[model samples]
Target: MTQQKIRWLVVLMSLALIGLVIFQVVGVRETLNAKEDQFDGSVTEALDAVAHKLEKTEVAVLTSRRLAAERRKEKLQQIAIHDRPAKTEPKGRKASPRKADPATIQRYASHSPIVQQWEFYGRVTVPSDVLNRTNGTLTDAEMHYVEEYYRNESPPLNPDNRLRSELEKTYDETMFRNLRKDVESVKARRDSVGKFLANRVVGDRKAAPVRKHMPKEAAAKPKVTFSRPRVSRIDSARLPHRHMTEFEKAEQKSRVMREVLLDMFTNDRPLNQRVDMAILDSLLKNEMSIRGISIPFEYGLRSDDNPHDFIFTSSPGYREDRLLDGYSMQLFPSDLMATDNMLYVYFPERQSYLAQQVWTTLVSSVILILVMASCFYVAMSTIVRQKKLSDMKNDFINNMTHEFKTPVSTISLATQMLSDEAVAASPSMLNRYLGIIRDENQRLGSQVEKVLQAARFDRGEVRMMRDQVDLHELIETVVHSLSPQVEARNGVMHTNLGAKQSIVTGDEVHLTNLIFNLLDNAIKYSGEVTDVSVSTASSADGVRVTISDKGIGMTKENLRHIFEQFYRVPTGNVHDVKGFGLGLSYVKKIVEEHKGTIRVDSAPGKGSTFEVWLPF
Candidate 1:
């Protein structure tokens, strides 16, 4: 390729690489979001199902217990009266009438709301076993009361009053004896019902003994009744039913499976992890056509947020409000051969759609990310190959700077040795050699120190020895150290230490170094008319130390890299500023080590102010 084409290729390649990175980041983010959406949907479904099942179970348990209690009561009454003697009475009150009086039976039925329902199966007719046995016990007990009343029969002197008192006593004795029998009967009945209920509720039929005491015939096959009834609210009765296409049927089945699985997986998890209500509603509304049978059904959720426990139900009515609403179904009771009754399951549909919309957006985003990521990877490989040369150059420069530290240290040692009189012949020769060595050494030392400081700062090895120190004294000392440098460069140093002395806990040596570094940087980087300002005070958060200078000022680009090691501003038309770019880096490290924060406020062609905030 020609140089012009290669250069164009380089630019194109760079753009492509940037695009790829952006795509990858965006794609990953989208994928994660989509996964969360799907998970949430599945969880919502599961929680709804779990809650519904729990509620239904509780209802079932309670109902079973009630029935069991009734049965127990009946059994106990039978056992209590098994040995009672038979009773005979005058014609007006025969113990065993040929049949129970219709009026009396109606009156008894009226007293029991539950008993009226049994009329649907027809009036319960049998030999008067229950009443006859019960009455025999009552008659025997009443006779005993009557005898006692007669034995205690006595008159009060007042004729009318005596008659009333004797009658009251007789009535009281009869009631007392009858109440005793009734108490035993009721107790027996309650026990029987409780035992039956507990057994059935636990689904442990074996735990309860079979009702052997029930009359051989009454204990036989349970009788059931059924009648066909017109279903109300059939809007399309005359509309011809259509057969589902094969593909449509398969799709329906798939949807059902998905709904069922999602419901099972996320049931009763938590609100945040719930499934989309809209999807569940849609699934329920769609009629399933399987094996030429179209079974229309609705799935719903019922949350009974009983503080005692979390309960959810997924049966017809329960699912309506939570998932979908008002799903019409051609539902048949499971015991279809026997009971023929219909219950309309109503669901509130409004909230269902709201939950679903949120879920769809979340899931689709993830898919979008995956698609974008794939596209990004394809673009990345094509552009990444041609940038090898620039990459290598950057690496070489960094490494070269890193390795220059050894030679710089050796030169500094040699400069110190030459400056010593022991290594020189005369004072004049020593001074000349020392001057030469010092000049070269300081030059090398600045470069080496900058690189080493940058490296140490990056590796986090440079540590501060901290102690409680007065801000006033620390700043004064730093100002004194920078005074000589300021005068040598023909620059003036100014200071404004606040009136109240701020005592803070920090490393004095590092604080001093940090302050000196800022001053030195300002003087070196500034124009000939260098004006540096140093100030210390207590700010809102803590102690504030600011070093500001008016120099040639930095360009935005140069300012960006000012704190980078070996990143000297290119002095094309400007005077060379000595030293590697470790000044700010070292300052930044020192300030941070003292649990203080540093910030810079500057702009190109203006002054720069570096602020260090130390907590007191």
Candidate 2:
């Protein structure tokens, strides 16, 4: 009982040790997982904060650039249209004063249609009476000057440029009847210069300057004039809300709201609890209403943080999350402040909870298996020990039977001789008693040899001195030894040994005994006039030795048990064959000691075939 209690204590201590190890492992894993979760949350918060800040900064920069560009355009317009030529100079002035340099005048003319028209009208001469009455000038030269300017250089006084004024201005329409031709020439020259610049100066490596010839006086002080369009203040670009459609507006709003919600999920711990479809919809509507933008949208939080599930913008564009350093990201709206509504998208949170759960389950299962394996190993060891004890008891019984049977048989024979007085008086009765003594002695010797063989095998003292034994020669010798028994049973032995000599590495005596055991089984199991066949062949796996007999064949189930100690087939026929059932078992043990396998294939009514395969 004390020993049993000690065993129980050992088992309990082992189980407790295993439990403690599992608990520590699990606790460490859980703590690591918690730390990882916290780290992930911190990373998400950092990323969301960064994305939100970037979105606002981007919106601000774009708005500043847009407003700045507009202001610069307004200043350029004011510079273009602040001055004018107040109804041509006084009559005594040098026709049109050369106030600026040629290039500056050309630039001034190129930028101002009024200046171009003034130069054209002032340079020409006309009939004094015809021009003076029309432009309110009195002298013939004044009238001539006005007529010359209108007739020779009236680029801006074309019919399409009908600058009607309340001052009631008039000109000889008949004198400018060919005005269309002049206008066409000016347009052709402008187009030529534009094409030349586009195809050569702007598009190629070399450009050829346009040149014109003039007289000595004109060449000494040459002037070129150009016609330029007027510039105006208060210029306008397309407004942000102008191009946006109702559908586009709604899409933009939804995109913005989605971005906001995603940001909340990443940064705010309580964001998930605050989420609902109605709240998102309301948020979008309220934001757009405040901006005086009409939009229709359905908004909700996407279950995941995939980019595809992010903002879906129909107007302006969408916002995308871009990964930055160490678990942070940047979100930037595509359309910027060029559009009426802007959206902000947040960073994504990686899925780690599912991985943690799987790891926990896997670890738990391993712990359970370890505990069960420990228990199974212990139980199997105890059962095997008990089985070994039972086998020793059976061996003792077999040994005792052999020890008593031989002497009793010899004594019985001697007593029978005494009982048969008539035979006892004769010499033949004495010979019978001597023969009985010899037979009993041989049986006793065999039993003693078996016990010694088993003891040697058990103690690992059966040494095998290996040599290259000729298999054909070995088998032939074994067959020669069994010839007498074969003849006694009147059994025909047919041998088909391979012509090629096969050599095996083994102790010659054991190999010979293995062959003899098979032959003995064949002779013992056979009925009268049995045909036993033995054959040997060489194969790649090893040499194969087959022995078969046409006898009372065993069932398939009995064939499997044949090699077990003390296991014998229950042959259905009533016969006088008895056996201790150790022959095949001994053969199997010897074959296995040489690293080989033995198999039997048989069924009821079909003869049994035994095959032994060994690898070289």
Q: What TM-score would candidate 1 get against the native?
A: 0.38
Residue-wise lDDT of candidate 2 within 317-411, one digit each (tens)? 33333311123233332322122122232223223533454566657766776776676677656655445445634654654575556567676
Give the TM-scores of the predictions, in the order they appear.
Answer: 0.38, 0.43
Task: State residue 371's C-alpha deviation in candidate 1, in Å.
Answer: 8.3
The most accurate candidate by TM-score is 2
Tens digits of per-residue lDDT, candidate 1, 471-550, equal 78877887787788788878898899873658887778777767778888888767777789888787666788888888
Residue 2 of model 1 has an lDDT of: 46
Q: Give the C-alpha lDDT of model 2.
A: 0.54
Judge candidate 1 at residue 259 and give its lDDT: 38
CA-lDDT, candidates in order = 0.52, 0.54
